[model samples]
Target: MNTHPAPATRETGGAIAPHLRRLLEFVEPDRDDVCLDVARGRGPMPAALGPQVRHLTAVDAMPAHAPGGHGASGTNGRMSTVEFGTGPVRIADGDTPPAAATREERRPHPLGPDRTLVKADASALPYRDNAFSLVTARFSLYNLGDPEHVLRELLRVCRPGGRVVIADLVRGNLTGPDRDRIERLRDPDHPGTPSIARLTEMITSAGGSIRRLDVFTVERPVEPWLAGSCDDATADRVRRALIDEVDGGPRTGAKPRIIGGELWFTQSWAHVAAEPIP
Candidate 1:
C-alpha cells in the first residue's frame, strides 16, 4: 500500500490573521443572525465570530478523505468526526496548536451553547439553502482544489440578501515558473496561490455581487514560516531563493528582503464580501 505524507497544517499566526476583523466588518452580524464559517482551519475566524453571532457553525475538510463522501462526483455519505482544535483569536508570532478546548473552556463564550462544529468537505456543505445570514471562508482558497464550487455552495447556504465573505492571500511580487514549484515543495497539498483578479472573477462568476473589497500587505519572517512544513533540504532551497530575491538575483514574487537583519517576505491579502443576487 502506498502512503502519502500528511498535509501541512498552515501556521495560524502573524499580523495577517487579524485581517478577518476587517473582513467580518462587511457582514456586521446582528445578535439574531446565524453565521457559517467554511473551511475554518484551526478556528481563528470562528473564534472571532463566536462572540458576535447568535448562532455559529464551523466546518473544515477532514484530514483524510471520507469513503463515498462529498467528492466532486456527487456521492454522499455520513461524515466522520475529526476534531479541529480551537484557540484564542489574535495575531502574534509563532505556531501554537492550542489543545482542543473543552466544553468547560467554551462555556464562558457568549455563543458557546449555540455553536456547532463539523469536519467535512467544503464542496458539499451539509446545511440547507437559505440557512445562514452570513457565510465566510478565510485563508482557504489556495488550499482548496475547487474554489468556485465552494463559493457556489457558500452562496447556496446563505439566506436571501445574506453575505458571503472571503479572506485570502493574493499572489504578490512572486512570479516565474519556480514560484509554484517552491511552494509545493514546502507543502505538497498547496495547490497554488491565486491573483486578486482571478479571485474577483471567480466570486462574480459564482453569482455573487461584490459589496466591498479590501487589500492589505503584511510582512512576515521567512525562516519560521518555512520551518513549519519543510525538511532541512527543502527549507535550505526556499531560503536560498528568498535570499536571491533580496539581492535582485531572481524574482519569486515572494517579496523577500532583509528586515532588521532578519530575512522576511511580503504578502498581500484580500478581504471581499459579496451577496447573491436576490
Candidate 2:
C-alpha cells in the first residue's frame, strides 16, 4: 500500500471530506469574490474549488513538486471523524499529509480559467494591498516562521470587509508539546504550531477583527499520517514515542490509542475567520 500523499481534492477518495465541506461553508464564498490560498500543503484547494468563485490563486514558498525525484500520488486519504471542538461565533463562520505533487503547482500557471498557482512567500506576497476579497492560509502557517508577520501580510492583501481564514494543527498546554516534537522529527521544516488563542490574538494584532472561530477534532490513523511525512526509521521512532505514551509513559498530546487494533490519534485544528479592522 502506497503511503506517500498527493494533494486531496473534493473528490479525492471518491467522497467529499467532511471537514473540508464544513470549511467551505464557513468561508461563505461568493460568486464574485477573488480568493487567495497560501501554502496549500495537503490539499489542492484552488484546483478543486476554483470554479466555484470568480478567481482563486494559491501561493507556496516551496516549489510545486517535492525534491529528489519523487513520484506523484499517495494512498488517496484516510477516513476521519471530524468533531466540532469549540469557540463561539459572533455572527459568521469558519494539515498536511506529505510532500507530494499538486495538479495546480506543477503545471503552468492558470490551471483553469479561474485558478493560478505561484511560488511566493507568505511574509512578502507579490500582490497589491487589498487585492483579494478572501485570503486563506491553511496548514502552512506553522511551516513558515513569524506568525504575526504572515498574518499581517494575509490581511494586507485582503480587501476590507473581506475575510481571512487561518487554520492549522494547534498545540495545547495540557496535552504538552510531545506531538509537535514528533512532527518535527518527521519534518524539521516546521517551525511550530501555535495554540488556538495565540493564533486568534495574532490576527487581531495584525489588524483583523475576529468574526468567528471554530475548532475541530480530527480522528485518524497514526501510521498513514506518518507514511509520507517521514522515512521508515523516523516513523518507527514516532511510533515508539506514541506507543510509549500509550503505555503510561507520558502524555503525547496526540492522544494516541488503539482502535480495532490499529493505532489512531486525534488532531485539534482551529479555524479563525476575521475581517480587516477598517
Candidate 3:
C-alpha cells in the first residue's frame, strides 16, 4: 500500500467539471446553507458550489506540520490561499504562528467572510456535531485511504435533515471492463473507484438516506490524463495498457478510442445526494 497521498485522480485545476451541473441542480445549494466539503482535494466541488451557498468550509486530508511556528496559535495548521475563481480560498498548509491570541482573536478573512479553510483529517473533523447544513465530498474521497470512516464523519457534522452530496469517478458498468486497474496504473495510491451501488450503500450505511443519484460520462484525453500525475515511465506503461486494450486486449474498463486523431478514453461518474435521517 502506498503511504503517500495521491494526486487528483482525474483532471486537475480548480475548475468544476461541466456535467456536475446536473448534480448541483438536483441538490440546489441555497444561500442559507452552511456547507462543509470533506476530502475536497483538488477536485472542483467546493469551488463550483461555494458561490451558490452562504458559507462553505473545505476540509483537506493533507497533514499540517507547522514549521518553526508561523500561523495562528492553536490552529490545526497554517493558512495558504488558492484562487478558486470567484475568490481566493484559504487552505491549511501545515503550519501556524503561535496564537498569542488574546480572547480568541477574530479577524476578517481575506477570502471573504463566508469561506473557511480548515486543516484536519477527514476521519476526524474538529467541528461540533450537527454543525453544517450541507456536507459534501467530491472526487477526493478515494484518496482518503478509508472512505467509509470519512463518510461517517461527514454525516456526523451534518445537521439532521441536512444534505450530503457526493460526486466521484465511479467504476464502469456492472459487467464492464476493469477501469480500476487502469486508474491504479495512473495513481498508485488509488484504492479502486467504487460502483454506483456501492457508493449509495456507503451513504446509507454511514447514516444518511439516499435522496437522488445520477450518472454521467466524460470523454477524457489520454495524454493529459497521464501527464497530470504519472511519471514518464508509468505514463508509458499506462499508455501501452490502454492502447493494448483498444487492440482486443483484456477489458481495462476505460473505453479508449481515437477521436479526431487524438487518443481518448471515458470515465463514468456518480453524483449522489443523501439526507441524514432525523
Q: Write the per-residue lDDT of candidate 3 for residues 1-278, one digit (tens) a residue.
A: 22121222222225333355545665567788899876533434566677788998876554222221011112322112211122111111211111111111243222445677775777777899899988887665655547787788878888876777787777644844366677777767566777788888888888888766666655656775675434788889888988898888977777787656666777766677777776
lDDT of 1 by residue, 1-278 (tens): 21121223322232334335445554466577689986534646666776678889887643224443411011222112212212212223533211121112333322256788776778788889889888888766544447888888888898766778788766644443455665676666666767777888898899887766666665566765676454688778888988987887878767676756778766566677777766
Clashing pairs in 3: 64-94, 65-94, 66-94, 66-95, 70-96, 70-97, 71-96, 71-97, 73-99, 78-95
What do the candidate models score in CA lDDT, each in turn? 0.62, 0.65, 0.62
Clashing pairs for predicted structure model 1, backbone only: 173-253, 174-252, 174-253
Measured by lDDT, the strongest candidate is 2
Worst 10 contiguous positions by lDDT, candidate 2: 69-78
Which residue window of length 10 is worst by lDDT in model 1?
A: 70-79
Off by over 4 Å in 2: 1-14, 40-42, 62-110, 173-175
Off by over 4 Å in 3: 1-17, 63-110
Error (Å) of candidate 3 at residue 240 is 1.9
Backbone clash count for every predicted candidate, in the order shown: 3, 0, 10
Q: Score candidate 2 by TM-score against the native.
A: 0.76
Clashing pairs in 2: none
**Candidate 1, number of clashes:** 3
Task: Please say which candidate is ahead in lDDT: 1 or 2.
Answer: 2
